[model samples]
Target: MKIAVCGKGGVGKTFFAGSLAGEFVLAGHPVIAIDADSSPNLALTLGLSAEQAKAIVPVAENEELVRLKTGTNYSGVFRLSFTVDDIISRYAVPTPSGASLLVMGTVKAMGSGCACPAHSVVRALMRHLVVERDEVVILDMEAGIEHLGRGTAEHVEILLVVTDANLKSLETAANICRLAQESGIRTIGLVSNRIADDRQEAAVRLFAEQHNLNVIAQLPFDPLVADAGMTGEPLDRSASSAIKAIGELAKKLRGLA
Candidate 1:
């Protein structure tokens, strides 16, 4: 299953993405968790130590690696076609929960008309993983999935836009849904996060029903998740309302594919 989890900032999308990766691995799939967020903390969410996360260099910031892949000597022409197969074994750090993590870092443009080698490497590696590779891939995307362009978006199986009871968050999810649909990513679902009570759950479900979007999951407001984050530990799956809900959501996603 190739899924992209996206949502507005502070909506707990990262937590959901981490849970999804954990669920996939628990199901016996060798998963690749992509930390595409500019400010990444998936390592902590995946139960990796701070030093281990820091050890996995963000591909965008690796100038030497980018130079090697893209041929920095030339201005106009660069190597776009290369193998990133070894990249997984060489760079990916394994989490305690049995998922390989690759921190993509932030891919930002220098200026207009600039041939960003880092961006090139990111795109190439992403294509390799999403299109060429066979493992389960989960991309914890930023508010906007700017890196996974139309070409890349088409190959992805689903884009799960996470939100809460807030109207603005749902609005952002709607906008992201439109963007993904435009890119030919048809299997888009809404994951409602942090519903404190049944009232909030009903409101979120009503909004999702009105929008004609599938409600993949509705996660409760569990303080344990926050505590886990604070402790820099992976969320405990047992009795975790959010994790249980996400496991069901993963089952639903598997059916979709």
Candidate 2:
């Protein structure tokens, strides 16, 4: 399955994506967790050391922007010389349980008309993974839906949007839903994070109902999650309320316990 997790900044999207991938790995599925966020934190959430994650070099290509001639028949060709396995072997980090992790490093913007080679390469690799890879591929995307708009949306089977229990966060979720609809990507549901009390939970549900969105899961505010983040611990094994909620959400998504 190809799952893409996205939301506004500070919405715990990475946490949800990482935890879901970890759960799948624990359930005996070979999983590939792609940290598509330029400012990535999924590696930390998955309990990977910084040194281990840094081993995988991102797909960096320098391509000249040239229009292809009509009837060139170049659709199946790739510009890169490296195979996916080679790239992964060189750059991917394996967790203790055998799941693989890949990070898409950040790229700086050049002047207008400047090509985005990193974005192109990441998009190509992602497409290959979704179409050819047998393992479950989970992409943890950045806050905005821009990546989805850039043709990656079709590769996603489920688009999970995360949000906090606040009016601004709910508004962002609604906006994301609209963007996803415009991009022709189907949303699986919303996961409300950092709920402080019953009132906040009620607010999240009401917001989802008003927007015609499904509230698939609710995660309470937990200090352990913060500590785990600080310590680079795996959230899947944490006993925190938020982590437990994420595990349940993973089961719901997988149609199993």
Candidate 3:
């Protein structure tokens, strides 16, 4: 399953994506978790230590790799096509969660359709991961789907727009849903995270109903999750009810696969 998780910043999409990847690993499936966010912190969430996560060089910022793949002899030219399969084997970091991590760092001009070498490399890799790879791939996207072109986004089997009960978060999720639909993604759903009670969940469901998007999962607000984040500790899957909920959600996603 090629799943893309997106939401406004701080909506816990990275946490959800990381936990979901770990669940798939626990299920005995190979998983590749892509940190496609502009601020790439999915590494830490995937059980990498702070030092290891900080040491990661995003694909977009790897000058030597970009020169090898897209650089040209001409002063202002680059290759549009290149084999990116080796990139995974060469750079994917193995995490304690049993999932491989690939950080696709941000390109300053990414959303503007820049054809620079770095952008070209990132785009090609995105296509390779979403459309060509066999493993279960999960992308923790940036603020929206604009970073992913239609061709790449179309191949994503599922687009999960995560949101909290905040009005701004729901609004951002609605916009993301629209963009994903336009990108030709067939299965799009809303993941309501950090719900404190029936009232919050109801608000999210009402928003989803209004926007005609399915509410796929409703995760309770777990203080344990917050505590882990504050202390930079790996979430305890054995103790976190939120992680268990994500495990069940992972099964539901696997059903689609």
Most lDDT-accurate candidate: 3
Q: Which residue pairs clash within candidate 2?
A: 56-91
Candidate 2, superposed: residue stretches over 4 Å from native: 54-56, 60-85, 107-116, 149-151, 231-238
- Sorted on TM-score, best first, the list reads 3, 1, 2
Best by TM-score: 3
Which pairs of residues collide in candidate 1?
Answer: none
**Order of models, best lDDT first:** 3, 1, 2
TM-score, cand. 1 vs. native: 0.92
Pairs of colliding residues, candidate 3? none
Model 2 lDDT on a 0 to 1 scale: 0.70
Q: Which 10 successive residues of model 1 have the least lDDT summed?
A: 107-116
Model 1 regions more than 4 Å off: 72-77, 108-114
Query: Residue 210 in model 2: shift from native, Å?
Result: 1.6
Is candidate 1 or 3 superior in TM-score? Answer: 3
| Model 2, span 15-107: residue lDDT tens | 778878887887788898888787776776777777865654554422222111111246644344333444556557777646688876653
Global lDDT for candidate 1?
A: 0.84
What TM-score, computed on C-alpha atoms, does each candidate reach? 0.92, 0.80, 0.97
Number of clashes recorded per candidate: 0, 1, 0
